[model samples]
Target: MTTPFSSLEDYIALPRVESLALSPDGRKAVLTVATLSTDRTSFDRALWEIEADGEGVPRRLTRSAKGESGAAFTGSGDVLFVSGRADASAAEAPDAPQLWLLPSRGGEARCLTRLAGGVSSIAATALDGETVVISADLLPSSRSIEEDAAARKRRTDASITAVFHESYPVRYWDHDLGPGVPHLLALETPGGDELPEVRDSVETGRSADESRGVYPSHLTSPRDLTPTPRRSADTAGQALTPDGRTLIASLRVAEKRSGRFVLVAIDVASGERTSLFDEPGVHVESPVISRDGRRLAFLRAPFHTADAPADQEIWVADIDGGDARRIATDWDRWPSSLVFDRDGTNIIATADHDGRGPIFRLPLDGSAPEQLTTDDFAYTHVAVDASSGDLVALRSSWTRPPHPVRVRADGEVFLLATPAGAPAPLGSITEVATTADDGARVRGWLLLPDGASAETPAPLLLWIHGGPLNSWNAWSWRWNPQLALAKGYAVLLPDPALSTGYGLDFIARGWNAWGAAPYTDLLAITDEAVRRDDIDEDRTAAMGGSFGGYMANWVAGHTDRFRAIVSHASLWALDQFIGTTDNSEFWQTVFTPRGLTENSPHHFVRDIVTPLLVVHGDRDYRVPVGESLRLWSELAEHHADDDGTTPHRFLLFPDENHWVLKPQHAVVWYETVFAFLDQHVHDRAWSRPAQLG
Candidate 1:
């Protein structure tokens, strides 16, 4: 049978690839496709290869059941990609989807490392046609989704907040020493070890089940890997050496909020390691050695402090270790996804310093970086031909979908192909700046209802994004402002105080000051939106999930400005959440040390006035269903008051987790939301059926 959804547009719109990597020769480009299942079927993902100059239709190179895409070309013509599948018996098992190999020129795909485990990270450089330097992961295994789904719902023997954590870490490759791989070496360092398996919970003295976080460890060469544990070195950055000798990595031993890291160089064969320069004051990010492999260029920034902006500087250090100097000091910039031109003369990196990421070129000798594009979009992803240095970058704006573009050295830009299905021209989209109660001017991008006029008030939806820290940009996508705009509602997203992109301080302000500034900004935005002559104040509604859900909950309790509210996967009870959710680290760092207090949401439940339709996944592990249940249960008790009576409803998607990943669930979701919003915000009247018509 055909799917219930009518058009592919509704079922799915955009191609699921968010990132891409080009082969050194730039003859082929790899597409990293992350797919969302149609139902609770199998989560499928694959890597598709396309010709660099728009000469080939994208062809799927691999069929993967558990999502395999980080595909890239080696110095040799051979291709290396992260290929794996879910352990049919476990969820994120360390023993599932071991590393595999494939030819760049298409041949048999073989399992390279049968360590019988999943690899979180992989780096490959061709020494010959058959050899490549690689890093794979080995972690403690857990039950698979299917296996866990097979079990009956069991009550927990103990109480816990954060649940269902999978702590998988990447380990460097040395012992297996894939045959003939050049620089096939291991560096001496610390950290990156598998945690002890927890057979069962010993609840009394021990708490609930939890995954162990990564620790500082010594990276001893295979010869010394046994345990004369030297100084610690930990890094999540790709563990690769260009010249194939000195392995450069960052150590995560320091206690800093910025996740401060230390960069150290290790001699793979000798197991001897030395700190390039201990960046104790802050953190150092991914370091890229020049193509010639003589110098290391990495981004450095101060540690994250409560009230400070993490200033970042791009610094280049000699491989032999000395004369480390800062080259780039734009606080607004950082090294984006990096790709060096195969010749190694110029380093290519993407930057979105001003909301739109354009490409920038940094010389190997640490000269000034030249901006490559004028129109903002993400220039961070580029496919530069190793042979000619001809660059192909993906660009998009709020109004534009990302499409690959070709840039010639002469400075001319050529469009490769329109994004798979570009949206029809937007009738009218304008940025609106509105002032809040505290005189804070919030900015928002407003998409107008096609047939509506300023004289005629339009139905409006004030959509709030969950990461309250995340900012709303001009991007056409699913479940975003586009969905509501197409449904005929003017969608408005306010760039409230705590939103990102403004600076680090603005983001940090969002921590413990949740309902304080954010709530205030939301109310001011709503009131300002209502004041506009083109809006229908009485027909307005609100919707958001996670942090957005918290806003909806708080708005309902404090104001009657909104007719209806939609809360999805939200944290409603801060008091209970600190002690109940798995986000205690965030709570401790961002919120308060004292935990939940008497001023929590449950204690202030009397403030709610607007009706709410609470939606959440039954299997959500992040913010458990317990939070939703508590909010809904409590809101139900106060459904009516002296002022007026409002209806409240609850809907749960079973088997779905924090993210509603299935297409079927999305269809059901949109329909339910439309029907609910119409019932409340439209203020329509209907007669009941009488006398059995």
Candidate 2:
């Protein structure tokens, strides 16, 4: 019997499991699952617990309106999570995310700490878990929590909404950064009636001397662990030692020339900080400390510039900052989600291979890395039990959503949890391979609708992945191709040049030239896919977002093979885009005017012949809305001389950010896209989406 997977409505309603965390004793595991709310407007996440031995059924642990996430375990086996739920006794802010603790055996979770600014992240020691470190936002002028609250009240009473900027990067991907600076605080919790106390450590606040940098003091109870005048240091990835004495974190230091990240260790008692690893133009991130507190493993990559593309490698070093070396240097794929085994002799990590994200074990003794997983499914948030050596991860594929699974050391994989609801039956997924113009092998995934065959062919939809630096190796909720398959159309997902999981040499081919090998690789793979008897070569369309969107625009201008093209949040003019994008500083460092002029798609817009649909979000600062605006204006001007019957449209989202997040908005996006494709690719009558009306 075949599984059931239906339309977009059914697809969005499926439960999605994001992360997995195992307890210190390795007896239980907690998984974070997100499901659509009752109103279907957004998703609400909750923590679920399962037996690590795969003996007990999955059980829901915490339930709240605001939802709980970022689950971590203490040494006592109690689960700690962050949530925005209010506390009646402490009069906590309703929107601030506070730390909550759930007892090891079984009991109601209680609030652990209440600060002016909610906690963003938490890390604990593996030995006793008595010491915890949390990152929170603090206003510059406020020296205490009460002062911070008063400052906020005064601003609200005065109806004042202004943010003073003294540094770069005023805004991030989806939110504004200002008014408050991020600070790290250490807390001691004994797990009893005794309340947690903040210890005096590093000093907090900015100095009056402008030359020293803008380090304003804020609500630092004890003190700040990292306090460098004028220079702002951000804590990205942090891991506490087993004894809770030293904290190792990836610190991004802002400089005049460029921003670079280094791994540093901070003493919990004396607040002394020492740089463990620092490179001139390389960034170190995702630091994971061993249980014995002897080694550190992290991923390092070159600082991305127009001239340089990111190529990641795994690095291992002694905790004392000695014997540092890079491992898996010859590995083709980029490693992520680093975790060390119980013996500390091996490091477990995940990387995209071909079209799947597989788990690999790299030995510390310089042995060849061994592939632990052999399947078409992708895995993430991997955790290994120290006692049993068994693994638990969230696995997904093109035909399936994310779910919890248990993999034994002997290569035995078992599904731990299956969501309750049933989705409509999906089409078959197969591998497609071909050789590029450079004689390099390229691979992709093809989804063929049910009943498709040589006699009964299906229309093709070429979907390019964003992050020209990323790969299509995992299941995606936003850019899902299953919905298109449900409409009787086959979808092709290709990994062209610049796509990760391939070696660094493959990415260098398209480093500064967006219209070169990457484009040719895509075309080569597409040609091989359409040659299949089950695919209808004449009836095809192309679509992509971000970097993929840039490719979509380039494909439309360079070729007339496709009937229609959809470009979302794409870059049209290289010169204008480089200056307006949120990352202008980085772009200015690596890109030159000459190279941009030669590769920009806007220079060749007049050659376009395919019908185009442009989509963008006003809040997308990464690739500003102006790119879409310019592309639409040029397309309109080019088609103005032709018959006014040309079907070209623009879909704009005012409230959405880089990605379409709202449930209703996502539904509308798919409806509009499918309707446009049906009209141009299938010769069907035009139908306006009901949601638009």
Candidate lDDT (C-alpha), each: 0.57, 0.80
Per-residue accuracy of model 1 over 1-693 as CA lDDT, tens digit each: 122122333446345555566775677777666555555333456776777787757777777556675665555545556666542222223334544445664665544332222333454343222323344322112122122212211212233222232221111211221111111223221111222333422443211221221111111112221121111223535345654455676655525222356777766555477777665666776777765666777777675433433555777767766878776444445455565665666667775443445677767565677877666455536766766778877666666666666777654677663225455544357667766665556676666666657677788898887766566654634355555656568877776766765555555445556667777777677777677777777789998887788777777777777888998888888766655554344454545543244225565677777778888887776677788999877876766555654477677887777767665566556666766788778875422223112
TM-score of 1: 0.74
lDDT leader: 2
TM-scores of the models, in the order given = 0.74, 0.92
Among these predicted structures, which one has the highest TM-score? 2
- Candidate 2 residue-wise lDDT, 205-255, digit = tens: 212321122222222243456553223446658888887788898888876
TM-score of 2: 0.92
